[model samples]
Structures are given as structure tokens and as C-alpha cells.
Target: MRWAPRGCGGTRPSPEHVKRNGWHDQNILVVSPDDQRLTWPERELVRQLGEKLYGTRNISEDRNG
Candidate 1:
């Protein structure tokens, strides 16, 4: 399935935000069954949208990597 943001192309998730939050190279634990079902691109879109709307560190990253 192709996922696109309404009125425009979807945004891309940036590792920069994670790095800025000092979470780069850290393990992020995402616990969403539905989200997990999405393809890699879709998951990325979700992450990107979340970061864009809510700023960095919106999603928690697991530090045990």
C-alpha cells in the first residue's frame, strides 16, 4: 500500500532529530502491532509525521542496544 500525506507528498523521518536528542545509535523500542504491520516505508512515514508534528524525541528509543 502506498501511503501519502494529504495535500502533499509525505515527509521523511530524519535521524538528525534522534541524534539531536542524543539518542542516535541507541535502540528504539516501538510497541505498536498495527504499526509493525506496516511496510518499512510506511513505518518511516509515520515516524517522520510524528517527528514533524510533535518535534524530536516524540517517540521513545530503547537504550539497550
Candidate 2:
């Protein structure tokens, strides 16, 4: 499956936002993984992607690492 923002003409995800937020921004398409508009699977995918990209860092881990 392929994903792209409307009118993006095949644009890619925003790396800056992803790095800054410690989460994948999906090219600014996904405002949040918890967005109710997204299907459960989509939300789950976003969460997993975020974890994979940023690592599953907890509050303590963030503070220390």
C-alpha cells in the first residue's frame, strides 16, 4: 500500500517534524495517533511507527537519555 497527502503529488513524510516530535509525522498527515478519525489499525500503525522511529522511550528514559 502507498500513502501520500492530498495534492502532494507524491510528497514524503516530514523528517523535521518526526525528529522534533520524537514521532513520525507522516508528512504532516497524522496530527496524532490518537485521532478518532483514524481507524484502529491506522492508529496502531502510527503508534508502532513512532516507537520504531523514536524508540520506546519513557519519561525517565527521555530525562536520562
TM-score of each: 0.36, 0.41
| Candidate 1, residue 45: lDDT | 76
Write candidate 1's Cα lDDT for 1-65 as tens digits. Answer: 48766766766557656544554356654423235668988877777776776675623666465
TM-score of 2: 0.41
Across residues 1-65, which tens digit of lDDT does each residue of candidate 2 receive?
48666786764668645555554443344346767978999988988898988887463555444
Query: How many angstroms is residue 64 displaced in model 1 relative to the true structure, after the best TM-score fit?
Result: 12
Give model 2's clash tally: 0
For model 1, give the 10-residue run with minimal summed lDDT: 25-34
**Per-prediction tally of clashes:** 2, 0
